[model samples]
Target chain A: SQQGEEDPQALSIQEGENATMNCSYKTSINNLQWYRQNSGRGLVHLILIRSNEREKHSGRLRVTLDTSKKSSSLLITASRAADTASYFCATAAATDSWGKLQFGAGTQVVVTP
Target chain B: EPEVTQTPSHQVTQMGQEVILRCVPISNHLYFYWYRQILGQKVEFLVSFYNNEISEKSEIFDDQFSVERPDGSNFTLKIRSTKLEDSAMYFCASKWETQYFGPGTRLLVL
Candidate 1:
């Protein structure tokens, strides 16, 4: 089964608008993490929400996790052109090695000025 | 702040040749991981290392692949014989609580 699957494969928004992307997973997880990648670059760790936590915030990023539903969402508030990048949700399974992450098909966000 | 780092930003090798990708994880990090992304696909986990041994590996990691932490800070992935399908960006990561990824090494196997 796919571990992480995100909704809305692509998104385009104007500056100052909000961008929300949803993700679902198939198994129990210790933590869910969000990552950002610019074109042709490595992924940058954004935020991590543990199964015990419902929601988390960091700067302009807000992440919510619903373990009961096996789902998570990432909301980028006040989007900016610089926010154009691919966002991915990765899960660290409770049964697996702690750092092994299974990533989802990312949300391609295009924040136009 | 400190971060993971990798060598050979890009590598082009012929199929069947051996290629070794190197990474220097965060000095204090104890867990290290290797992942790869084929151009348009999701990032896939290849293997994880801790205490100088492999903790776990994915199916994608076969006999053709091997990993080592020969020294204290250097971790490496060696593909015994490259294949066309091996072309992708290989990323090395280190874990504290949050994983820190290094700028990936893009490999092109022709």
Candidate 2:
């Protein structure tokens, strides 16, 4: 499995500040996706960036993928206390025709009021 | 909004016992997958089922593991002879293109 490795295992930010987390994979990917898990609950899909796309935004979330570097970044702007959660990056490896994903260890974000 | 649903948020079983996890995928979704996450670990894929059969499975999905779509809506994962290491969070996901995950079943094999 081509699991992505996330940097800065934990992050802390004040409300209204921006939060960014980076993920790196060792293999080529068909697409990269970001998911958020509140506590031990299920994962919520945030965004997906294809190998060809550079950047994408959904509401206050921005995802940037760099295929050449095999890395991606997730940015959350104007963070709120409710946004505190563990964010994971998953990669759909190009060699995996079934589209099975490999997930990262996740970044724990703490948003304080 | 349609989403995947799972039953029995938690399950506790003795070692060597059998356990089955159930999931109901979105009506329109075509692909169903199973993943497991141990506490403090990343989620790992177990298997992917489509067209009423298994399309792919990982090394971790061995003879002890099996999956089935017994009905049009329900998908199941059965673990034979659960081990202590099998204690983890199990998630079921459905995908048309992007996947939607169901709340996981926390399995505790003692």
Candidate 3:
């Protein structure tokens, strides 16, 4: 089965700094998505990058996809205290039409004020 | 912007008892999905529904678990017999090109 594994399980940084996390998957995917979950709360959709796309950006969030390496990275620039959350990378397989997402363990990000 | 909604923000049930979790996906979305996250664990996919039928389910969705879309607006997940391990935060998602998730229901099987 295809699985996404994120590196640096936990990260802590001061506000205004940049935080980057990497995710590596096992199989081909149609698109990769990034989601944020506040402590014990629901997930919020952040961004989605397609397999054909190399990079994309949304406000302060920047995402890069390298299908060749079966990996992706998410960069949060100028992080704020409110950005403290668990960041997850989920993948939608190329063959799955139902749009099932395989989620990674996630990177726990703590943005200190 | 429309968002998915779930009922019973929190539920506490005894082991072996049955419990049903309800969700109302985005009004115009065609595909729906259910996922759960154990405390401090990764979120896992449970099942996906489309056109009023289950399109895909993960191994975690066993015979004891079932889903229904009885009314046009509501989608539900029923656990016939809950176990201690069944405790988790259940989330519902509606898909367009991208998926929008609900606030989630926290189920505690004690």
DockQ of each: 0.86, 0.90, 0.95
lDDT of 1 by residue, B1-110 (tens): 99999999999999999999999999999999999999999999999999999999989999999999987889999999999999999999999888889999999999
Q: For model 2, which pairs clash?
A: none
Model 1 chain B poorest ten-residue lDDT run = B94-103
Which ranges in model 1 have alpha carbons more than 4 Å from their true place?
none
User: Candidate 3 at B109: error in angstroms?
Assistant: 0.6
- lDDT per residue for candidate 2 within B1-110, as digits (tens), equals 99899987999999999999999999999999999999999999999998999999989999999999998999999999999999999999998878889999999999
DockQ value for model 2: 0.90
The TM-score obtained for chain B of candidate 3 when compared with the true chain B: 0.98
Candidate 2 per-residue lDDT over residues A1-113, each given as its tens digit: 47899988999999999999999999999999999999889999999888999999999999999998899999999999999999999998889878898999999999999
Which lDDT values do the candidates have, in the order given? 0.95, 0.94, 0.95
List the candidates' TM-scores in order. 0.98, 0.98, 0.98
Arrange candidates, best lDDT first: 3, 1, 2
Model 1: colliding residue pairs: none
Total clashes in model 1, counting residue pairs 3 or more apart in sequence or in different chains: 0
Shares of reference contacts reproduced by the candidates, in order, are 0.81, 0.89, 0.97
What candidate 2 gets wrong by more than 4 Å, as runs, is none
